[model samples]
Target: MTLLFAYTSLYGQTLNYDVIRNDKSMGQTVVKRILKGDELTYHLNTKTELRVIFLFDIEYDLKETFKNGKLISGTGFNTLNGSVQKETQMALKEKFYELVIDGIRTEINETNITESVSEIYFEEPHHSKRVFSAYFGRYLNFEKVGERQYSLTSPDGTNVYTYENGICTKVKVTRDFATFEFILKPESLLAVRNKQITGKTND
Candidate 1:
């Protein structure tokens, strides 16, 4: 029966997810959909069109709305090259961030995802979002074991490991009976060479 106000993040990359009551009198908390674009799309707000251009696909004409601890909206078209992938509705809320995925609808509280991450700031060595790096607050670090694998620790001292390319593939957050999780895809680092080499083209 704890009532909480609203929460905001500093940057944007950090995702914020929370739990909320349905009727406020039902005495039952429900998982709500907040922001679909976490720290990756924090720059987007009302009256703004955020464009996410990926190597494989491009997302244009995107819209977002924030209210009542919930985020509801949809994109115009999701195209890989020139075709469309139908229209999909993307909705999430802050309250839902606190509850475990399955824990929300059922009594089971378990899911493999990170929930409610916000107020993130990038330090030195990272300029123009080209490279992503964080302090991890002295609590999170890289642990070496085999060849390409790592273990990431959360703020509450929870450890989640990955064993594919030594990168964080997923993040999970849970409190009381709620858990939220998210999978992260690696960013593209292919530089575009726009230099023209010429040795004096004679007549």
Candidate 2:
């Protein structure tokens, strides 16, 4: 899950994907990134509902701020079945991260950041570590299987991601209890941006 895109200039981009489970559309996830000055901000939002024995719904949101390739602060909110499950805030200290979860304060080392998994997608290649999990959560291990294919393993299960031109084209998650796949839409962020610019100039 390494991204090799050059980011020397400030820009804002958005990626949209369809979340599918058992070949059915379950929800959608939107990831937005904004680069300004020396700071980069990433925001992810996901919403899904499943009608099984009962109506089950979930919503998750994550916001992270990074400076010079290091995480500075982050916030997370998660809801399941229409009830709030967790709310957290985190800030990086000298050698640790101070996390406030549900109003309870705790300190964690940089090795255990909750959003570490997301970093795997944006870091440079040939680094020391290829797999990393959440600071206090699940463990994730990633291995490059092919030119554009990667295998990601976690306590929950295993998943595979295929990327093309620095954009993830497909993701397959398989677990004992559930299996899901995320497919990138044909309309990418770059295409949308170019279309908007073209429309404005023609007007």
Candidate 3:
């Protein structure tokens, strides 16, 4: 499952979310969006650690650059157990998108330039098959289930996203016997932050 925020305003903002599994805090995700001139940059960072018989941890970092609503470049790295396992980079050429995975370059059709789960946050009408998964390194298809709900299916599992005011509030992914959920922090927290900012501005 992917956690994404749709920014309606050009102003920069950062979003924080808590990842949960079995009603317990598993990890957190941080997303930041910045706009400068005609370009928009998005950064996403995720970390998860599970301790059972042995300690297992994973981290994913991604950055995407968009110009005029089209993705121009992307780079990401994935680490498992504190060691980098995979790295990927992509750039849009004149007519095609070049993807390099672990030093291997592959040319992708220009029409399929859309390649990132976070891109769903910028999608129009809230439904599309143009979304991509970096973990799978392929595009996934999605269907709108409700006014503010959508579902995406991949070989690994199905992910359902619920949004509030176009911002993804909850995501549930079910794969076989495991189900994971990630939810936005309470609105009260956000309201408090806004109130503090407003108070400072007035002072």
Candidate 4:
């Protein structure tokens, strides 16, 4: 539900991923980052469908705008089976930050929110060790594990990110319900070739 990201450039870019579980497609996640003068904005969305006792759908959205190097505001929603599970809105105030989660509001002194989890989808966080979570309204741990790989741990779960050439190639999200894998759309197309190379069966 969270990610770690850093700004590597001022240019804009978009990234797409296929959510997969047990060699089957569950849904997709799309992320975009835009630049306008000294301000930068990012959006992240994920939609998934699965069946346990019954079929259900899940959608998650997050939006944030930053100026210079400080956060201005952010909004997010998590919906499950057509019902909202969580919602939050955060904005910068004159003295501190204000956050409202599910109609309850609070004040935060963590004023400097430059980087967050969304950036991990586009740029490599080579020097970033921690990132703020817009949803959780707190900072989380991010650790570099291997070359082009990193791990993020939070209360919900732990996630692993894999990158190639500074772009995220895949992500493994661990949840209490199940493990979800987000593979870059372009890289996911290699499944067929991989089956042939390894002589494996998806079914």
Candidate 5:
């Protein structure tokens, strides 16, 4: 019997569930944990729309399973893949293993152009947390854009680090179309990461 957790949709009008499959007890989905089966299944319901059975995951890696589906494509964790390293694991226990970074800023050659800068903060991994940050750019000079601006490159130019318990796991960047995969150890996010959106700078 697979373990299951049921959640209401954001609107509260629909229901969602995670389930495990077994041929012996088919069609009677048990709301339990770790169903003794080869695959994991998810179901979602929406108002005024047919309930959808999202893609099934034969393997729990599930990176491809969720990204390939039409209904749940952009829903979650599409651009991160990799495991945390020993260094990161050790760093997590430290009282202050924090990094504050800046994202890419650009300056156009035209007479009137806007240069933008964004700030980012990362903490040593806590128990059961994953943090993912991706940077994209127009050229290799993401680092040279401006003050307080870090380079934003695709996975090829992007580097990922997971720091926990004083150990750091580095994930090399690689592109998968509009997204990349940088799997983080869940225990590494001591605090929530600020997204890369920019705002007006102090004069």
Candidate 6:
């Protein structure tokens, strides 16, 4: 806790979460933030190993840069078994943002792009309508469900996030593979190991 406190006070915050599937620990996700002058950087990565008739590994990485609270660039990569599956890049332009997924490039006409999918780990969304998904190179709609909780729905599936204070404590992901949850380490590590969070469920 001392290290976490120091990190929270100095550079930024480090949130460690245990990836749970069927009440079992599969892997983990680590999120970090660094504040320097007028530039802020957020990084996140996830490692999940499970069996789908056979044993395989999956990983996802993301990095986002913000200058004066405006998104400058963001990139993400998804891999399977150490091989790259998808790569996405978003760079800021004059009045629009240049977004490239795989090798295809597109233009986003939104000015002052701020938040994306990765920022949800550090701050809670009280009235956010949507957040940009770098992996999908699109915007995902956000819906406020219960207190301090919000849901982001995409073509893939719906992801529910629960927050405390101003930080996210839990993320419930409903995907095609299976349903899993990311529980904030140490702080909520014990309370959520047994039961699921009570709130609105996507149907």
lDDT per model, in order?
0.25, 0.64, 0.68, 0.77, 0.21, 0.80
Runs with alpha carbons beyond 4 Å of true place in candidate 1: 1-9, 14-64, 89-203
Residue-wise C-alpha lDDT for candidate 5, range 127-186, written one tens digit per residue: 222222212212222332232323344444453333322222222233342222233223
Pick the TM-score winner.
Answer: 6
Q: Residue 109 error for model 3, in Å? A: 1.5
Per-residue CA lDDT of model 6 for 1-203, tens digit only, reads 96875555556656789999999988999988788888889899999997878877999899999998889998999899999999999999888989898989989888787768778876676555677887877778788888878988888898899876556788999989789999898854433233221111222
List TM-scores for all candidates, in order: 0.21, 0.75, 0.79, 0.83, 0.16, 0.85
Arranged by TM-score with the best first, the candidates are 6, 4, 3, 2, 1, 5
lDDT of 2 by residue, 98-182 (tens): 7888888887655434335554333322212353332333335567776656777766578777665455556787878577887
Stretch of 10 with least lDDT, candidate 1: 188-197
TM-score of 2: 0.75
Q: How many backbone clashes does candidate 6 have?
A: 0
Order of the predicted models by lDDT, top scorer first: 6, 4, 3, 2, 1, 5
Per-residue accuracy of model 3 over 1-203 as CA lDDT, tens digit each: 11232233344655667878888887887766678889878788889775556766979898888888788888999898989998999888988878889988887776445446765443322456457655566778778787667899998799887754445657787877467786767752363244311111100
Q: State the displacement of the C-alpha of residue 76, model 6, in Å, after optimal TM-score superposition.
A: 0.5
Error of 3 at 73 (Å): 0.5
Q: Of 2 and 4, which scores higher on TM-score?
A: 4
Which pairs of residues collide in candidate 6?
none
lDDT winner, 2 or 3: 3
- On the 0 to 100 scale, the lDDT of residue 134 in model 5 is 15
Off by over 4 Å in 6: 1-8, 187-203
Output the TM-score of candidate 5: 0.16
TM-score-better candidate, 2 vs 5: 2
